[model samples]
Target: MVMDEKGMVMNANSDNLPKDCPQISETVNLIVHAGQKYATKFNGKMFAFDQQQWNVKPCAKINITFINDDQIRHQFMIHGLPGYLYPDGMVHLELYGEGELKASLIVPSQKKTYLVHCELAQHAEKGMKAQLKVGGGDGDLPNISAISSPIKMDAYSIDWTMLKWGGMVILVVVTLIFVSGRWLLFRHFSRRK
Candidate 1:
């Protein structure tokens, strides 16, 4: 039993405590233990343990320190988020070179469920996925067995030339329309004069 700042008795294990008990203004420290052995056989998934899950309130600012205990590289990524609130719609922490990787992020005030997993290959599909309960989660996240197998292919490749050319085409079209409209208006006025 731990006493909150408001002197209220909170059963540390109980999840049904009052929401207004106290504002958890202090920074919360989270440790994500990683290793290659935790990888699942289902396409070499990573972080196989369910104990890797983490949950917290919406307004809390968390400091996550990932300690890599394995010889291989590991990653911590979150998904299914509002991109407007969190850029890239995800938070990626890679521990490829070893040592420890630390990062901090503040959760949005809206209550929602988010997926945390390793994005390397078939990590999330195997067992590297966990549920984060923001402001309270929507029950338990889908288990490793419940997740569909990842498509075995490279999905990150993008055609930079196409993207750049598409943007330039749009810009040129807009500029031409503006210039043509202005030229027509000027010619009409000059003829009337």
Candidate 2:
């Protein structure tokens, strides 16, 4: 782990290869931005990465530039990596606040989907989560913002019992306004004629 005032990069591998991979298939430079502005399009979300999903070839090396636009701490972490290459099968990049950090990791030669998220408290649940797909990925992860269906969706159910009377009152008021306007217009036209 390399940490300083700006940020930290942990378990990053640029040249190290996994046991199953012969060599690096390709190199990818990915720039990911994390902030509240990125979550504007998603309802009830306050934070998010710029992209919800990323696709890469098997055994590919990815160099990531993580920029946290918020004035709060944010992390760019990848899980389910090869333990031999990455300690604890994960690569973690974190910015203490609004900052940037560059890190690299080489994925194994397997068709699987890896979870990428911010491990900060309530960050992932609030929409700071994404998916890194290797070789098209096995399948999609749940609750990945607008990418897949959440395990437990947020329901905005209203109680008709409480609003039924209020709704009827509003409808009546609108109808009365409409009828009154039409009657006034008709009376004025008749008088003019």
lDDT of 2 by residue, 20-62 (tens): 9998999999999999999999998989999999999999999
The local distance difference test score of model 1 is 0.61
- The number of the candidate with the highest TM-score is 2
Give Cα-based local distance difference scores for all models.
0.61, 0.93
Worst 10 residues of 1 by lDDT: 8-17
RMSD of 1: 15.7
Write down the TM-score for model 2: 0.79
RMSD, every candidate, angstroms: 15.7, 9.2
TM-scores, all candidates, are 0.54, 0.79
**Best lDDT goes to which candidate?**
2
